[model samples]
Target chain A: MKLMIYAAALFAGMSLSIEGAIYGELGKSIGKLESSFYNFFVGTIILAVVLLFFGKGSLSHTFKAPKWQLTGGLLGIFYLTILIVSIPLVGVGLSMISVIVGQMIMSIVIEHKGWLGSSPSKIQKEKAAAVVLMAASLFLIF
Target chain B: MSILILAAAVIGGVLLSAQSSINGAFSKQAGTYESTFLTFASGALVLFVGILFFGQGDISAILDAPKWQLSAVWFGVGYLFLTVLAVPKIGVIATNISTVIGQLSMGILIDHYGWFGGLQIPFDWQRGVAIVLMLAALRLIYIADRKSALQKKQAA
Candidate 1:
Protein backbone atom coordinates (compact mmCIF):
# COMPACT_ATOMS: atom_id res chain seq x y z
CA MET A 1 0.00 0.00 0.00
CA LYS A 2 2.80 2.36 0.89
CA LEU A 3 4.58 1.56 -2.34
CA MET A 4 1.39 2.14 -4.27
CA ILE A 5 1.11 5.52 -2.62
CA TYR A 6 4.65 6.46 -3.56
CA ALA A 7 4.09 5.29 -7.10
CA ALA A 8 0.98 7.41 -7.21
CA ALA A 9 2.98 10.46 -6.14
CA LEU A 10 5.55 9.87 -8.88
CA PHE A 11 2.85 9.35 -11.44
CA ALA A 12 1.09 12.49 -10.29
CA GLY A 13 4.25 14.50 -10.71
CA MET A 14 4.85 13.23 -14.21
CA SER A 15 1.24 13.77 -15.14
CA LEU A 16 1.32 17.37 -13.95
CA SER A 17 4.55 18.02 -15.81
CA ILE A 18 3.05 16.72 -19.02
CA GLU A 19 -0.05 18.79 -18.41
CA GLY A 20 2.04 21.92 -17.97
CA ALA A 21 3.80 21.27 -21.26
CA ILE A 22 0.52 20.75 -23.02
CA TYR A 23 -0.94 23.87 -21.45
CA GLY A 24 2.07 25.85 -22.56
CA GLU A 25 1.32 24.88 -26.11
CA LEU A 26 -2.35 25.64 -25.81
CA GLY A 27 -1.82 29.06 -24.28
CA LYS A 28 -0.34 30.28 -27.52
CA SER A 29 -3.55 29.91 -29.50
CA ILE A 30 -6.46 30.07 -27.11
CA GLY A 31 -7.49 32.49 -24.41
CA LYS A 32 -7.19 31.18 -20.90
CA LEU A 33 -10.96 30.81 -20.52
CA GLU A 34 -11.39 28.77 -23.67
CA SER A 35 -8.44 26.61 -22.80
CA SER A 36 -9.83 26.02 -19.34
CA PHE A 37 -13.29 25.37 -20.76
CA TYR A 38 -12.03 22.66 -23.01
CA ASN A 39 -9.97 21.22 -20.22
CA PHE A 40 -12.88 21.00 -17.79
CA PHE A 41 -15.17 19.76 -20.53
CA VAL A 42 -12.87 16.89 -21.43
CA GLY A 43 -12.19 16.09 -17.80
CA THR A 44 -15.90 16.00 -17.09
CA ILE A 45 -16.51 13.69 -20.02
CA ILE A 46 -13.80 11.30 -18.92
CA LEU A 47 -14.88 11.26 -15.29
CA ALA A 48 -18.52 10.84 -16.24
CA VAL A 49 -17.67 7.80 -18.29
CA VAL A 50 -15.61 6.32 -15.50
CA LEU A 51 -18.38 6.87 -13.04
CA LEU A 52 -20.99 5.36 -15.31
CA PHE A 53 -18.97 2.29 -16.16
CA PHE A 54 -16.73 1.57 -13.20
CA GLY A 55 -18.18 3.44 -10.26
CA LYS A 56 -20.76 1.64 -8.13
CA GLY A 57 -23.23 4.13 -6.81
CA SER A 58 -26.51 5.84 -7.52
CA LEU A 59 -26.91 9.19 -9.25
CA SER A 60 -27.19 10.74 -5.80
CA HIS A 61 -23.57 9.99 -5.09
CA THR A 62 -22.61 12.23 -7.94
CA PHE A 63 -24.45 15.19 -6.47
CA LYS A 64 -23.98 14.42 -2.82
CA ALA A 65 -20.61 16.11 -2.51
CA PRO A 66 -20.36 18.43 0.47
CA LYS A 67 -20.63 22.18 0.11
CA TRP A 68 -17.07 22.89 1.17
CA GLN A 69 -15.79 20.45 -1.37
CA LEU A 70 -16.93 22.73 -4.15
CA THR A 71 -14.18 25.10 -3.12
CA GLY A 72 -11.71 22.76 -4.76
CA GLY A 73 -13.13 23.64 -8.13
CA LEU A 74 -13.02 27.34 -7.37
CA LEU A 75 -9.43 27.00 -6.35
CA GLY A 76 -8.66 25.14 -9.57
CA ILE A 77 -10.00 28.00 -11.61
CA PHE A 78 -8.03 30.52 -9.61
CA TYR A 79 -4.84 28.51 -9.83
CA LEU A 80 -5.18 27.92 -13.55
CA THR A 81 -5.99 31.52 -14.32
CA ILE A 82 -3.17 32.90 -12.23
CA LEU A 83 -0.77 30.39 -13.70
CA ILE A 84 -1.65 31.24 -17.29
CA VAL A 85 -1.64 34.94 -16.59
CA SER A 86 1.56 34.83 -14.62
CA ILE A 87 3.51 32.71 -17.07
CA PRO A 88 3.14 35.21 -19.89
CA LEU A 89 4.00 38.13 -17.68
CA VAL A 90 6.72 36.66 -15.54
CA GLY A 91 8.17 34.01 -17.79
CA VAL A 92 7.73 30.32 -17.15
CA GLY A 93 10.70 30.07 -14.83
CA LEU A 94 9.73 32.92 -12.57
CA SER A 95 6.04 32.05 -12.56
CA MET A 96 6.87 28.50 -11.63
CA ILE A 97 9.21 29.68 -8.92
CA SER A 98 6.43 31.73 -7.41
CA VAL A 99 4.08 28.79 -7.63
CA ILE A 100 6.53 26.47 -5.92
CA VAL A 101 7.05 28.93 -3.12
CA GLY A 102 3.33 29.28 -2.69
CA GLN A 103 2.71 25.57 -2.79
CA MET A 104 5.39 24.74 -0.25
CA ILE A 105 4.25 27.25 2.34
CA MET A 106 0.59 26.35 2.03
CA SER A 107 1.23 22.63 1.93
CA ILE A 108 2.97 22.75 5.27
CA VAL A 109 0.05 24.54 6.89
CA ILE A 110 -2.49 22.26 5.28
CA GLU A 111 -0.73 19.03 6.23
CA HIS A 112 0.04 20.06 9.77
CA LYS A 113 -3.45 21.17 10.66
CA GLY A 114 -5.30 18.68 8.49
CA TRP A 115 -7.47 21.54 7.29
CA LEU A 116 -10.38 20.59 5.04
CA GLY A 117 -10.91 17.34 6.92
CA SER A 118 -7.70 15.67 5.89
CA SER A 119 -5.80 13.49 8.33
CA PRO A 120 -3.70 15.58 10.66
CA SER A 121 0.06 15.52 10.78
CA LYS A 122 2.41 17.87 12.53
CA ILE A 123 4.88 19.88 10.50
CA GLN A 124 8.40 18.75 11.14
CA LYS A 125 11.23 21.26 10.87
CA GLU A 126 13.42 19.05 8.69
CA LYS A 127 10.67 18.52 6.17
CA ALA A 128 9.95 22.23 6.16
CA ALA A 129 13.59 22.97 5.51
CA ALA A 130 13.65 20.45 2.73
CA VAL A 131 10.74 22.22 1.07
CA VAL A 132 12.56 25.52 1.44
CA LEU A 133 15.63 24.01 -0.18
CA MET A 134 13.49 22.81 -3.05
CA ALA A 135 12.13 26.31 -3.50
CA ALA A 136 15.63 27.77 -3.44
CA SER A 137 16.61 25.33 -6.18
CA LEU A 138 13.86 26.80 -8.35
CA PHE A 139 15.66 30.14 -8.24
CA LEU A 140 18.84 28.43 -9.36
CA ILE A 141 17.19 26.50 -12.18
CA PHE A 142 14.87 29.21 -13.43
CA MET B 1 3.44 45.34 -9.43
CA SER B 2 6.03 42.87 -8.28
CA ILE B 3 4.71 43.18 -4.75
CA LEU B 4 1.20 42.58 -5.99
CA ILE B 5 2.37 39.56 -7.87
CA LEU B 6 4.05 38.24 -4.80
CA ALA B 7 0.93 38.80 -2.72
CA ALA B 8 -1.22 37.07 -5.31
CA ALA B 9 1.16 34.16 -5.39
CA VAL B 10 0.94 33.81 -1.64
CA ILE B 11 -2.84 33.94 -1.70
CA GLY B 12 -2.89 31.48 -4.55
CA GLY B 13 -0.77 29.17 -2.50
CA VAL B 14 -3.17 29.26 0.39
CA LEU B 15 -6.06 28.55 -1.91
CA LEU B 16 -4.19 25.67 -3.48
CA SER B 17 -3.38 24.26 -0.08
CA ALA B 18 -7.01 24.37 0.91
CA GLN B 19 -7.95 22.81 -2.37
CA SER B 20 -5.44 20.05 -1.93
CA SER B 21 -6.71 19.31 1.54
CA ILE B 22 -10.30 19.24 0.39
CA ASN B 23 -9.35 17.06 -2.53
CA GLY B 24 -7.63 14.63 -0.19
CA ALA B 25 -10.69 14.35 2.01
CA PHE B 26 -13.01 13.98 -0.96
CA SER B 27 -10.86 11.30 -2.52
CA LYS B 28 -10.87 9.27 0.64
CA GLN B 29 -14.60 9.56 1.16
CA ALA B 30 -16.01 9.58 -2.35
CA GLY B 31 -13.42 7.70 -4.38
CA THR B 32 -11.61 8.99 -7.44
CA TYR B 33 -14.17 9.20 -10.20
CA GLU B 34 -16.95 10.94 -8.36
CA SER B 35 -14.67 13.33 -6.57
CA THR B 36 -12.85 14.24 -9.75
CA PHE B 37 -16.03 14.64 -11.70
CA LEU B 38 -17.61 16.85 -9.10
CA THR B 39 -14.58 19.03 -8.83
CA PHE B 40 -14.37 19.58 -12.57
CA ALA B 41 -18.06 20.08 -12.90
CA SER B 42 -18.11 22.68 -10.21
CA GLY B 43 -15.02 24.32 -11.60
CA ALA B 44 -16.56 24.45 -15.04
CA LEU B 45 -19.58 26.20 -13.65
CA VAL B 46 -17.34 28.79 -12.06
CA LEU B 47 -15.48 29.24 -15.32
CA PHE B 48 -18.73 29.62 -17.13
CA VAL B 49 -19.75 32.45 -14.86
CA GLY B 50 -16.43 34.17 -15.43
CA ILE B 51 -16.90 33.85 -19.15
CA LEU B 52 -20.37 35.20 -19.00
CA PHE B 53 -19.48 38.15 -16.82
CA PHE B 54 -15.92 39.10 -17.65
CA GLY B 55 -15.04 37.61 -20.98
CA GLN B 56 -14.15 39.82 -23.93
CA GLY B 57 -13.46 37.25 -26.60
CA ASP B 58 -15.91 35.91 -29.12
CA ILE B 59 -17.57 32.67 -28.19
CA SER B 60 -16.93 31.38 -31.69
CA ALA B 61 -13.22 31.38 -31.00
CA ILE B 62 -13.81 28.37 -28.79
CA LEU B 63 -14.81 26.34 -31.79
CA ASP B 64 -12.04 27.83 -33.92
CA ALA B 65 -9.33 26.79 -31.53
CA PRO B 66 -6.68 24.83 -33.36
CA LYS B 67 -6.67 21.04 -33.21
CA TRP B 68 -3.52 20.95 -31.13
CA GLN B 69 -4.96 23.42 -28.69
CA LEU B 70 -8.14 21.46 -28.25
CA SER B 71 -6.13 18.39 -27.46
CA ALA B 72 -4.77 20.07 -24.36
CA VAL B 73 -7.88 18.87 -22.57
CA TRP B 74 -6.16 15.59 -22.05
CA PHE B 75 -3.80 17.35 -19.69
CA GLY B 76 -6.73 18.24 -17.46
CA VAL B 77 -7.77 14.62 -17.32
CA GLY B 78 -4.28 13.60 -16.37
CA TYR B 79 -4.19 16.27 -13.67
CA LEU B 80 -7.45 15.12 -12.16
CA PHE B 81 -6.38 11.53 -11.96
CA LEU B 82 -3.02 12.44 -10.50
CA THR B 83 -4.40 14.65 -7.76
CA VAL B 84 -6.98 12.08 -6.74
CA LEU B 85 -4.47 9.28 -6.50
CA ALA B 86 -1.43 11.06 -5.13
CA VAL B 87 -2.41 13.66 -2.54
CA PRO B 88 -3.77 11.34 0.12
CA LYS B 89 -0.92 8.90 0.10
CA ILE B 90 2.14 11.12 -0.15
CA GLY B 91 0.72 14.09 1.72
CA VAL B 92 0.56 17.51 0.10
CA ILE B 93 4.17 18.67 0.43
CA ALA B 94 5.88 15.64 -1.01
CA THR B 95 3.37 15.35 -3.81
CA ASN B 96 3.69 19.05 -4.64
CA ILE B 97 7.50 18.99 -4.42
CA SER B 98 7.66 16.08 -6.80
CA THR B 99 5.29 17.87 -9.11
CA VAL B 100 7.28 21.11 -9.05
CA ILE B 101 10.49 19.23 -9.75
CA GLY B 102 8.93 17.31 -12.57
CA GLN B 103 7.47 20.45 -14.08
CA LEU B 104 10.68 22.46 -13.78
CA SER B 105 12.79 19.65 -15.20
CA MET B 106 10.46 19.13 -18.13
CA GLY B 107 10.08 22.85 -18.70
CA ILE B 108 13.84 23.27 -18.87
CA LEU B 109 14.22 20.37 -21.23
CA ILE B 110 11.49 21.67 -23.46
CA ASP B 111 12.96 25.13 -23.54
CA HIS B 112 16.48 23.88 -24.09
CA TYR B 113 15.56 21.47 -26.88
CA GLY B 114 12.69 23.45 -28.37
CA TRP B 115 10.50 20.42 -28.00
CA PHE B 116 6.92 20.71 -29.17
CA GLY B 117 6.19 24.45 -29.33
CA GLY B 118 8.66 25.46 -26.64
CA LEU B 119 10.89 28.46 -27.15
CA GLN B 120 14.54 27.62 -27.46
CA ILE B 121 17.05 28.80 -24.95
CA PRO B 122 20.80 28.59 -25.40
CA PHE B 123 22.10 25.85 -23.15
CA ASP B 124 25.09 27.10 -21.24
CA TRP B 125 27.14 26.30 -18.18
CA GLN B 126 24.99 28.36 -15.82
CA ARG B 127 21.81 26.64 -16.97
CA GLY B 128 23.56 23.28 -16.69
CA VAL B 129 24.68 24.03 -13.20
CA ALA B 130 21.19 25.16 -12.28
CA ILE B 131 19.75 21.87 -13.48
CA VAL B 132 22.26 20.01 -11.37
CA LEU B 133 21.33 22.04 -8.32
CA MET B 134 17.63 21.39 -8.92
CA LEU B 135 18.27 17.68 -9.10
CA ALA B 136 20.32 17.82 -5.95
CA ALA B 137 17.55 19.62 -4.15
CA LEU B 138 15.06 17.01 -5.26
CA ARG B 139 17.38 14.31 -3.98
CA LEU B 140 17.58 15.98 -0.61
CA ILE B 141 13.82 16.14 -0.31
CA TYR B 142 13.40 12.53 -1.37
CA ILE B 143 15.95 11.49 1.26
CA ALA B 144 13.94 13.36 3.84
CA ASP B 145 11.00 11.21 2.90
CA ARG B 146 13.04 8.10 3.54
CA LYS B 147 13.82 9.35 6.99
CA SER B 148 10.15 9.98 7.53
CA ALA B 149 9.36 6.45 6.48
CA LEU B 150 11.95 5.09 8.86
CA GLN B 151 10.50 7.09 11.69
CA LYS B 152 7.06 5.75 10.92
CA LYS B 153 8.34 2.21 10.87
CA GLN B 154 9.95 2.65 14.22
CA ALA B 155 6.77 4.10 15.64
CA ALA B 156 4.78 1.15 14.34
Candidate 2:
Protein backbone atom coordinates (compact mmCIF):
# COMPACT_ATOMS: atom_id res chain seq x y z
CA MET A 1 0.00 0.00 0.00
CA LYS A 2 2.77 2.42 0.87
CA LEU A 3 4.62 1.36 -2.25
CA MET A 4 1.59 2.11 -4.34
CA ILE A 5 1.36 5.61 -2.90
CA TYR A 6 5.06 6.13 -3.61
CA ALA A 7 4.60 4.96 -7.17
CA ALA A 8 1.71 7.32 -7.66
CA ALA A 9 3.84 10.19 -6.43
CA LEU A 10 6.60 9.04 -8.74
CA PHE A 11 4.24 9.03 -11.69
CA ALA A 12 3.03 12.48 -10.68
CA GLY A 13 6.60 13.69 -10.76
CA MET A 14 7.15 12.19 -14.19
CA SER A 15 4.11 14.00 -15.48
CA LEU A 16 5.52 17.23 -14.05
CA SER A 17 8.76 16.75 -15.95
CA ILE A 18 6.92 16.33 -19.23
CA GLU A 19 4.74 19.30 -18.45
CA GLY A 20 7.82 21.35 -17.67
CA ALA A 21 9.35 20.55 -21.04
CA ILE A 22 6.19 21.34 -22.92
CA TYR A 23 5.69 24.57 -21.03
CA GLY A 24 9.32 25.46 -21.64
CA GLU A 25 8.63 25.43 -25.36
CA LEU A 26 5.39 27.29 -24.88
CA GLY A 27 7.18 29.89 -22.78
CA LYS A 28 9.71 30.39 -25.55
CA SER A 29 7.02 30.81 -28.14
CA ILE A 30 4.94 33.10 -25.99
CA GLY A 31 6.18 35.15 -23.06
CA LYS A 32 6.82 33.30 -19.80
CA LEU A 33 4.03 35.07 -17.96
CA GLU A 34 1.80 34.73 -20.99
CA SER A 35 2.41 31.00 -21.22
CA SER A 36 1.65 30.62 -17.54
CA PHE A 37 -1.49 32.60 -18.03
CA TYR A 38 -2.44 30.39 -20.90
CA ASN A 39 -1.85 27.27 -18.82
CA PHE A 40 -4.02 28.35 -15.89
CA PHE A 41 -6.60 29.81 -18.23
CA VAL A 42 -6.92 26.67 -20.26
CA GLY A 43 -6.63 24.48 -17.18
CA THR A 44 -9.48 26.28 -15.56
CA ILE A 45 -11.69 25.59 -18.51
CA ILE A 46 -10.74 21.95 -18.65
CA LEU A 47 -11.30 21.34 -14.97
CA ALA A 48 -14.57 23.23 -15.09
CA VAL A 49 -15.89 20.80 -17.67
CA VAL A 50 -14.60 17.78 -15.76
CA LEU A 51 -16.12 19.03 -12.54
CA LEU A 52 -19.44 19.41 -14.26
CA PHE A 53 -19.48 15.69 -14.93
CA PHE A 54 -17.34 14.20 -12.15
CA GLY A 55 -16.95 16.59 -9.24
CA LYS A 56 -18.57 15.64 -5.93
CA GLY A 57 -17.76 18.32 -3.35
CA SER A 58 -18.85 21.79 -2.57
CA LEU A 59 -16.61 24.45 -4.02
CA SER A 60 -18.42 26.88 -1.76
CA HIS A 61 -16.67 25.24 1.16
CA THR A 62 -13.51 26.68 -0.34
CA PHE A 63 -14.59 30.17 0.66
CA LYS A 64 -15.31 29.06 4.22
CA ALA A 65 -11.95 27.31 4.48
CA PRO A 66 -9.03 28.98 6.14
CA LYS A 67 -7.72 31.93 4.19
CA TRP A 68 -4.16 30.63 4.21
CA GLN A 69 -5.21 27.38 2.56
CA LEU A 70 -6.38 29.29 -0.43
CA THR A 71 -2.89 30.45 -1.24
CA GLY A 72 -2.16 27.40 -3.38
CA GLY A 73 -2.66 29.32 -6.60
CA LEU A 74 -0.43 32.14 -5.49
CA LEU A 75 2.20 29.71 -4.35
CA GLY A 76 2.09 27.93 -7.68
CA ILE A 77 2.66 31.19 -9.50
CA PHE A 78 5.43 32.23 -7.14
CA TYR A 79 7.21 28.91 -7.54
CA LEU A 80 7.33 29.11 -11.31
CA THR A 81 8.21 32.79 -11.36
CA ILE A 82 10.96 32.28 -8.82
CA LEU A 83 12.48 29.45 -10.84
CA ILE A 84 12.27 31.45 -14.01
CA VAL A 85 14.06 34.35 -12.36
CA SER A 86 16.60 32.44 -10.27
CA ILE A 87 17.60 29.80 -12.80
CA PRO A 88 19.03 32.49 -15.05
CA LEU A 89 21.00 34.02 -12.22
CA VAL A 90 22.32 30.79 -10.80
CA GLY A 91 23.12 27.89 -13.08
CA VAL A 92 20.35 25.38 -13.69
CA GLY A 93 22.28 22.70 -11.83
CA LEU A 94 22.66 24.78 -8.71
CA SER A 95 19.10 26.00 -8.88
CA MET A 96 17.75 22.50 -9.24
CA ILE A 97 19.78 21.13 -6.34
CA SER A 98 18.89 24.03 -4.11
CA VAL A 99 15.23 23.56 -4.86
CA ILE A 100 15.39 19.86 -4.03
CA VAL A 101 17.20 20.52 -0.78
CA GLY A 102 14.71 23.18 0.15
CA GLN A 103 11.86 20.85 -0.61
CA MET A 104 13.28 18.07 1.53
CA ILE A 105 13.98 20.39 4.41
CA MET A 106 10.58 22.02 4.28
CA SER A 107 8.83 18.71 3.93
CA ILE A 108 10.62 17.40 6.98
CA VAL A 109 9.49 20.39 8.96
CA ILE A 110 5.93 20.08 7.70
CA GLU A 111 5.71 16.41 8.55
CA HIS A 112 7.29 16.86 11.94
CA LYS A 113 4.94 19.68 12.86
CA GLY A 114 1.82 18.07 11.39
CA TRP A 115 1.35 21.27 9.46
CA LEU A 116 -1.16 21.48 6.65
CA GLY A 117 -3.13 18.68 8.32
CA SER A 118 -0.44 16.06 7.64
CA SER A 119 0.06 13.53 10.40
CA PRO A 120 3.03 14.22 12.60
CA SER A 121 6.07 12.10 11.91
CA LYS A 122 9.05 12.67 14.11
CA ILE A 123 12.32 13.02 12.28
CA GLN A 124 14.55 9.99 12.54
CA LYS A 125 18.21 9.42 11.71
CA GLU A 126 17.21 7.32 8.73
CA LYS A 127 14.95 10.04 7.41
CA ALA A 128 17.73 12.56 7.76
CA ALA A 129 20.11 10.28 5.96
CA ALA A 130 17.59 9.73 3.23
CA VAL A 131 17.27 13.45 2.67
CA VAL A 132 21.03 13.88 2.62
CA LEU A 133 21.41 11.07 0.12
CA MET A 134 18.64 12.42 -2.07
CA ALA A 135 20.21 15.86 -2.05
CA ALA A 136 23.56 14.37 -2.97
CA SER A 137 21.96 12.46 -5.83
CA LEU A 138 20.35 15.61 -7.19
CA PHE A 139 23.69 17.37 -7.04
CA LEU A 140 25.18 14.58 -9.08
CA ILE A 141 22.33 14.36 -11.58
CA PHE A 142 22.06 18.09 -12.29
CA MET B 1 25.55 30.81 -7.19
CA SER B 2 25.23 33.73 -4.80
CA ILE B 3 23.50 33.14 -1.49
CA LEU B 4 20.54 35.26 -2.56
CA ILE B 5 19.95 33.34 -5.75
CA LEU B 6 20.27 30.08 -3.88
CA ALA B 7 17.75 31.28 -1.33
CA ALA B 8 15.32 32.28 -4.05
CA ALA B 9 15.58 28.91 -5.71
CA VAL B 10 15.08 27.12 -2.44
CA ILE B 11 12.08 29.24 -1.67
CA GLY B 12 10.67 28.16 -4.98
CA GLY B 13 10.85 24.58 -3.80
CA VAL B 14 9.32 25.54 -0.47
CA LEU B 15 6.39 27.06 -2.27
CA LEU B 16 6.01 23.86 -4.26
CA SER B 17 5.81 21.74 -1.11
CA ALA B 18 3.37 24.16 0.44
CA GLN B 19 1.25 24.14 -2.69
CA SER B 20 1.05 20.37 -2.62
CA SER B 21 0.10 20.26 1.03
CA ILE B 22 -2.52 22.93 0.70
CA ASN B 23 -4.03 21.45 -2.42
CA GLY B 24 -4.10 18.02 -0.84
CA ALA B 25 -5.98 19.25 2.19
CA PHE B 26 -8.33 21.29 0.04
CA SER B 27 -9.10 18.32 -2.17
CA LYS B 28 -10.21 16.28 0.82
CA GLN B 29 -12.96 18.77 1.41
CA ALA B 30 -13.82 20.13 -2.02
CA GLY B 31 -13.16 16.96 -3.99
CA THR B 32 -10.08 16.66 -6.18
CA TYR B 33 -11.40 18.15 -9.39
CA GLU B 34 -13.29 20.87 -7.59
CA SER B 35 -10.19 21.85 -5.63
CA THR B 36 -8.12 21.82 -8.79
CA PHE B 37 -10.66 23.83 -10.68
CA LEU B 38 -10.71 26.47 -7.99
CA THR B 39 -6.95 26.71 -8.05
CA PHE B 40 -6.73 27.14 -11.79
CA ALA B 41 -9.71 29.40 -11.91
CA SER B 42 -8.31 31.65 -9.25
CA GLY B 43 -4.85 31.43 -10.75
CA ALA B 44 -6.15 32.26 -14.19
CA LEU B 45 -8.04 35.21 -12.83
CA VAL B 46 -4.88 36.58 -11.27
CA LEU B 47 -2.74 35.86 -14.32
CA PHE B 48 -5.27 37.54 -16.53
CA VAL B 49 -4.73 40.72 -14.58
CA GLY B 50 -0.99 40.12 -14.62
CA ILE B 51 -1.06 39.83 -18.38
CA LEU B 52 -3.11 42.93 -18.64
CA PHE B 53 -0.38 44.77 -16.81
CA PHE B 54 2.91 43.05 -17.62
CA GLY B 55 2.48 40.32 -20.20
CA GLN B 56 4.87 40.85 -23.11
CA GLY B 57 4.47 37.75 -25.22
CA ASP B 58 1.89 37.42 -27.92
CA ILE B 59 -0.81 35.35 -26.25
CA SER B 60 -2.13 34.42 -29.68
CA ALA B 61 1.00 32.33 -30.26
CA ILE B 62 -0.62 29.57 -28.23
CA LEU B 63 -3.24 29.14 -30.91
CA ASP B 64 -0.54 28.24 -33.42
CA ALA B 65 1.05 25.67 -31.13
CA PRO B 66 0.83 22.03 -32.13
CA LYS B 67 -2.12 20.16 -30.72
CA TRP B 68 0.16 17.86 -28.76
CA GLN B 69 1.78 20.80 -27.01
CA LEU B 70 -1.56 21.92 -25.67
CA SER B 71 -1.98 18.59 -24.00
CA ALA B 72 0.71 19.63 -21.56
CA VAL B 73 -2.03 21.07 -19.39
CA TRP B 74 -3.42 17.60 -18.89
CA PHE B 75 -0.03 16.40 -17.67
CA GLY B 76 0.00 19.30 -15.25
CA VAL B 77 -3.49 18.32 -14.18
CA GLY B 78 -2.45 14.74 -13.63
CA TYR B 79 0.52 15.81 -11.56
CA LEU B 80 -1.50 17.99 -9.21
CA PHE B 81 -4.32 15.49 -8.98
CA LEU B 82 -2.01 12.68 -8.00
CA THR B 83 -0.13 14.89 -5.58
CA VAL B 84 -3.40 15.87 -3.92
CA LEU B 85 -4.24 12.25 -3.43
CA ALA B 86 -0.79 11.19 -2.24
CA VAL B 87 0.25 13.82 0.30
CA PRO B 88 -2.49 13.19 2.88
CA LYS B 89 -1.79 9.48 2.79
CA ILE B 90 2.02 9.40 2.53
CA GLY B 91 2.86 12.69 4.20
CA VAL B 92 4.64 15.57 2.54
CA ILE B 93 8.26 14.39 2.71
CA ALA B 94 7.62 11.00 1.17
CA THR B 95 5.41 12.32 -1.58
CA ASN B 96 7.79 15.18 -2.42
CA ILE B 97 10.87 12.98 -2.51
CA SER B 98 9.18 10.31 -4.58
CA THR B 99 8.08 12.93 -7.05
CA VAL B 100 11.55 14.40 -7.18
CA ILE B 101 13.05 11.02 -7.94
CA GLY B 102 10.50 10.43 -10.67
CA GLN B 103 11.03 13.87 -12.16
CA LEU B 104 14.79 13.51 -12.34
CA SER B 105 14.59 10.00 -13.69
CA MET B 106 12.29 11.09 -16.48
CA GLY B 107 14.37 14.19 -17.11
CA ILE B 108 17.48 12.07 -17.56
CA LEU B 109 15.72 9.84 -20.05
CA ILE B 110 14.49 12.82 -22.02
CA ASP B 111 17.95 14.35 -22.16
CA HIS B 112 19.55 11.09 -23.18
CA TYR B 113 17.07 10.60 -25.98
CA GLY B 114 17.23 14.23 -27.10
CA TRP B 115 13.47 14.28 -26.97
CA PHE B 116 11.56 17.42 -27.98
CA GLY B 117 14.59 18.79 -29.85
CA GLY B 118 16.67 18.83 -26.69
CA LEU B 119 20.41 18.25 -26.74
CA GLN B 120 21.31 14.57 -26.71
CA ILE B 121 23.31 13.94 -23.59
CA PRO B 122 24.24 10.31 -23.35
CA PHE B 123 23.60 8.54 -20.08
CA ASP B 124 26.79 8.46 -18.03
CA TRP B 125 27.93 6.51 -14.98
CA GLN B 126 27.36 9.52 -12.77
CA ARG B 127 23.66 9.62 -13.62
CA GLY B 128 23.36 5.91 -13.05
CA VAL B 129 24.96 6.23 -9.64
CA ALA B 130 22.70 9.15 -8.86
CA ILE B 131 19.61 7.13 -9.65
CA VAL B 132 20.84 4.23 -7.56
CA LEU B 133 21.46 6.60 -4.67
CA MET B 134 17.95 8.06 -5.04
CA LEU B 135 16.35 4.64 -4.96
CA ALA B 136 18.30 3.84 -1.85
CA ALA B 137 17.13 7.05 -0.27
CA LEU B 138 13.53 6.24 -1.05
CA ARG B 139 13.90 2.83 0.51
CA LEU B 140 15.42 4.30 3.63
CA ILE B 141 12.66 6.89 4.01
CA TYR B 142 10.00 4.28 3.56
CA ILE B 143 11.44 2.04 6.25
CA ALA B 144 11.87 4.96 8.61
CA ASP B 145 8.28 6.14 8.13
CA ARG B 146 6.93 2.63 8.43
CA LYS B 147 8.80 1.99 11.64
CA SER B 148 7.52 5.18 13.20
CA ALA B 149 3.97 4.59 12.02
CA LEU B 150 3.95 1.11 13.48
CA GLN B 151 5.32 2.39 16.77
CA LYS B 152 2.59 5.02 16.94
CA LYS B 153 -0.05 2.40 16.27
CA GLN B 154 1.29 0.26 19.09
CA ALA B 155 1.37 3.24 21.48
CA ALA B 156 -2.26 3.86 20.68
TM-score of each: 0.79, 0.82
Best by DockQ: 2
Considering every candidate listed, which one attains the maximal lDDT?
A: 2
lDDT of 2: 0.77
Docking class of 1: acceptable
Please give the C-alpha DockQ score of model 1. Answer: 0.47
User: How well is each residue in B37-135 modelled by candidate 2, as lDDT tens digits?
Assistant: 888888888888998999988898888988777887888889877987898898866886788778777767766775654345678888788778877
**Leading candidate by TM-score:** 2
Poorest stretch of ten by lDDT in candidate 1 chain B: B114-123
TM-score of 1: 0.79
True contacts kept of each: 0.49, 0.74
